[model samples]
Target: MPIYSSDSDNETMPRTKLFGRQRPIRSVLGGGQVADVLLWENKGVSAALSIGMTILWFLFEVAEYSFVTLFCHISITAMLVVFIWCTSAEIFNWTPPEMPTSILDKSTFHEFASTFHERFNQALSSFVDIACGKQPALFFAAIFCLYILSVIGNYFTFLNILYLCFVCLQTLPFLYNKYEDKVERYAGELTREVKKMFRRMNSNVLSKIPRGPVKEKKAR
Candidate 1:
């Protein structure tokens, strides 16, 4: 009797080939490729539109009316708040649970508490740096200065423009710096926390598994 090798045994085994000497099926729909192309096109269009809008807003400011300027400022503030909230939500989703529990059993408070450490700290740090960094001795001094300047300049419509310019100048640097630094730091911390939690949970599960010769045999 001849010894059979694994490869020869496999070849000789009674089995039906799935597609016997036939050309592989070609994709008919091209769904994924089509979707990717569409997404790229959409992103390009969105970027173009954003650039156009920024230019238009600048032009609008130059030819500004008091009411329109105030409206734009309020709108920008609302947009910033919404943006921050959405970012915080994304961070929350990325973070892992410190304690193990079924998804269905999770409470809103527990979720918030677990996620708040990183997101809230980043937000607070950014807000403080932007609003309180320049004149730390008197917090909100920028706001106070703007208010005084607005009054001193006699509520002049053109002064609104000047005030807006000054506010942007003072705040933009802090915003850019904090946004670059703090948000990334918080994201890093959240990612590290998630990895640590997963490791701990894995260790806990592995520890609970029985260990010994019988256990090893059973595993096999």
Candidate 2:
């Protein structure tokens, strides 16, 4: 004999099925139109702010102060570089491959630091692509050479030497592909661990049941 009957199964069937046929074209089209409108609105706002900043920069430059002018120029240049790097990164989705187990088994801090370094390099690469028209090796070489020149010109002042070290570090991306791969692997592992921890905690709580007395047992 079956534990459940056909009528019982039908009664237990969900009011709303979990899986069903896809929606009609009219519904999808309406959703797409809403998304398009949102996108356009966001872009329009960004453009307006960008134009406003440019106008403000121009006004600042018109004021006859050398310090203000220099500050404005540097700030604007930095903003442009950041904006370009971010936009290019988003467009390319330049995420590297996961790190191998051999690499990630090392120190956690070292792995996380490496991941940060890799992201920084990717950002720099995007900037180089825009500046040098996508010749990565040449771009790196030019940057390295400039750092060398700056150090030599400054006669190895502490600040200049520090800057040169940073330049060399940034140029590492051009030399080895494995760095980005390792970073990605470490990041993935960390994410997996976090999710697993949360899941374990959730399961532990869910497995606990409230204690209650049965009617016959309580009566006894």
Candidate 3:
């Protein structure tokens, strides 16, 4: 039996058609209509903001501001927003139009906290499984090495290395959209090569390892 109805299904399922392919350049850089008018709606404005933010990062570098201070300021601003929202909605009967009253409500915070905690635990468990789970010893070791490198990056980071990524986010998508077919062809070729390399490695090295207790089924 086919997974999709013959009449309804065309080249792709509705959900796949929506999300699986590269998003339209217009839709992505914000040509699509939205109920809210956020900063990212216009491509030109988005590009300008990214450039401005990159310049600000350069200024911060010249000023010798630490990453700790940069992150602290962001945290403080977020806390201030929460404080103002709670106080205004509860005591003054005044709430900013932009700040939703639902977010300030006590029950809403509890539900958000519960959901966040659940997701965090799920992510942590998945990471642990990848590092120490039933995978071959060599694969687990490789993951562990990558985790160590990620931890080391925290200590050696510079301002440009951190914020340049955000700057690239603004421009890279537009470029990709313009040259999507060429980019995808290259990506497909690269992926096939990587898969071939991994298969060879598995046959020559990983397959030699004996199954450890990590992969053993628990007697039920």
lDDT (Cα, tens digit) per residue for candidate 1, span 1-220: 3232344444454532222313211111122322222233345643554465455555556655456766788799988986777777688885432443554334544544545565577768866776756557456766787689778677455644654564553344335333644654555556556656666666677657896755445564
Screening candidate 3 with a backbone cut-off below 3 angstroms (N, C-alpha, C), the clashing residue pairs are: none
**Residues 37-113 of candidate 2: C-alpha lDDT, one tens digit per residue:** 22333455435544654554445444434557667887999889877777777789965434345732345446446
Report the candidate with higher lDDT, 1 versus 3: 3
Off by over 4 Å in 1: 1-48, 51-178, 211-220
Residue-level lDDT of model 3, residues 1-220, one tens digit each, is 2132232332242322222456665544333222011224465656666677866776587767677887798799999988878877878787643655563467545654665576688768867776675567656677788799688678756565667667565556656666777886666656556656776777777877897666768799
Q: In angstroms, how far off is 12's CA in candidate 2?
A: 38
Write down the TM-score for model 3.
0.41
lDDT for position 84 in model 2: 78
Q: Model 2, clash count? A: 1
**Each candidate: RMSD to true structure?**
27.3, 26.6, 13.2
Q: In model 2, which regions exceed 4 Å deviation? A: 1-66, 69-178, 206-220
By summed lDDT, the worst window of 10 consecutive residues in model 1 runs over 21-30
Steric collisions counted per model: 0, 1, 0
Query: Cα lDDT of all candidates, in order?
Result: 0.51, 0.51, 0.60
What CA RMSD would candidate 2 show? 26.6
Q: In TM-score terms, which candidate is top? A: 3
